[model samples]
Target: MIGQFPPIILASKSPRRQELLKLMGIDFTVVLKEVDESYPSGLNPTEIAVYIAEKKAKAFDESIRNEIVITADTIVSLDGQILGKPETADHAFEMLSALSGRRHDVITGVSLLKGHKLYSFYELSEVFFKPLSAEEINYYIAACQPMDKAGAYGIQEWIGMIAVEKIIGSYSNIVGLPTHRLYRELCRITAQ
Candidate 1:
């Protein structure tokens, strides 16, 4: 039987991530800390995501003990451009407009730290949006408050319910964390 893992510390403020972890039956504590999210200019989407997640993991002091510190970064990439959180409503609208009836990649990178050892991995989900109207976008944004979400939208929101026609990878990745892979990795780490 799978047993409980060591004490885990999640370094994220995302309600979705928290809920996902709880849904997975994993016991972990939230430990928020600010880390410089900026990355090098030449990095790809997965690289950028992993870099930031590892950076957040590194923010914890080296004195950390038995607890496993977890950090993650999610990025929405369309074409070759990275779409972060929307700065304003108009920005959200613009992002939604561009994404309408298009396909984009949502990548989430995760890092787990125990003492000085670190394990990092990334998951990519391709999302396909149905043709959406300006009114639909506006209404969804007003109802869901997606300004803080990457890609200006959340896959579990009303917009996702209506606009997301298909998904090619982990649904949890689009939600901010890749739960299945994370659970498997945790099992491996705990077994060690």
Candidate 2:
């Protein structure tokens, strides 16, 4: 499947995304570019994700040749409010506290740029968390240091192992990238 695609460039600094791409059996190089992830007002979670992803892809506009550049952004939204990465341990605790015994949406926006053509899409997953105690949340924060992840948590970490009660849609999406959807999209684009 990877052979069908052109040389791939992953324009992200996320280790999870890099690992996921490697696990998908796709050969790619990681290219980091600073991108402002802010979105305009009134955009929903899905739109924000796709917007940031495309914005990141656009950073490579001047450098891209024939290689396919992939970029993605993931966000966790509770109700209608977005919960981005925590700025401090206290903030992480607050975010986790709000997420306790609640359901939230984890949306990942992805973009693929090749030559002059660009495509963007998104995947959303519903995650339910069981009620978490203060001790549990504090412990997870101190031990895991979830300041780098959205929603103050990683679904593959200790918090997820103990707190996640149920999930609907793609698991890999919550981890950062939607591998199946990405693979299908790659196939579709490469076939064209």
Clashing pairs counted in every model = 0, 0
Candidate 2 residue lDDT tens string, 105-173: 999999999887889999999999999999999999999999999999999999989999999999999
Candidate 2: Cα lDDT at 51: 96
- Give the per-residue lDDT digits (tens) of candidate 1, residues 41-85: 999999999999999999985747999998999999999799999
Each candidate's root-mean-square deviation in Å? Answer: 0.9, 0.9
Instruction: After the best TM-score superposition of candidate 2, give how far the Cα of residue 10 lies from its true spot, in angstroms.
Output: 0.6
lDDT of 2: 0.94
The residue ranges of model 1 lying beyond 4 angstroms of the native Cα positions read none
lDDT of each: 0.92, 0.94
